[model samples]
Target: MNRSDATLFSGGHKGAEAEFGKLAEKFGINEVNFTFEGHDIERKVGLKILSPDELKKGDVSMDIVSARMGRNFSKVDTIRKVIQSIFHMVNSGYQVFVVGWILPDNTVKGGTGWGVELARLFNRPVFVYEQDRKAWFSWIDNTWVEVTPIISHKTFAGTGTRNLSEDAKNALEALFERSFSES
Candidate 1:
């Protein structure tokens, strides 16, 4: 598979997002990190700070979001920008990959979960490296199925939890290697 033209759209925050940006740099793939002012993110290589107007394009009712995810957001106002930024990332990428825990309730944990939901709503291919399970799972037929995912799409999104585990870090590295390593 050719990775020369691969582009990763990410939030570029700490943990998995930062790791993804680093790996994209290592493999010479283009990366775009969507962020807004006052948002603290670790990766700055491809920062695209969205203006207030741009952010408004991605906005939706927090009540609707909570209804879709089957849960309420603690601080609706503060997390609004993050949801908007994620909208840009997922909207740009045809595929979504993440590193986080999958709860028994079937929803992925934290803010990253919103991305997964958006990807599903968009009908884009979504994969998550379940931290506790230590395996990759793809959203298929409304279920999480174990699979070994590679970067097949020219454009993809990488994101996940801030509390990344060592195993999850290695999994992300392996994913890049498997996708970009020369035959």
Candidate 2:
């Protein structure tokens, strides 16, 4: 597959999202970072600033979000917009890649977890790189199964915690290497 033909969907925040954007650039892959007004992003490449109407298309009640992830999120405009934009990322990407820790409750940690939960809800192919375990896990049959995942879809998502780890960074490099090599 021509790497340039592939597009990465991400938030373009620091840590995993920014790293993913960098890797996407290194691999000659296109990237689109979704955001709304007043949102601060570390990487500015391919930013698609969603209009209020556009952002509203992905909006959902925080109560529903909390119920799905088994945790309560702060009720705030910024966080709401973040969640709404994440819905767009997952909706646009057929496959999703994330870097973060998966809690025992099966939900991923933090706001990144919302993306994972959205992926699951949308039935998108989602992979999570656990920094603590130094391993990758894929969502399969309602469970997170350890596996070696690659960038299979031409359009996929890369998201995770802002607090990235060295191993996670290396893991992403390996992922790009493994993907383009096999391609």
Model 1, range 135-163, lDDT digits (tens) per residue? 99999998999999999989999999999
Q: Per-residue lDDT of 1-183 in model 2, one digit per residue for the tens?
A: 678789999999999999999999988899999998889999999999999999999999999999989999999999999999999999999999999999999999999999999999898899999999999999899898999988877999999999999999999999999887653
Candidate 2 overall Cα lDDT vs. reference?
0.94
List of clashing residue pairs for candidate 1:
none
Error of 2 at 127 (Å): 0.4
10 residues in a row with least lDDT, candidate 2 = 174-183
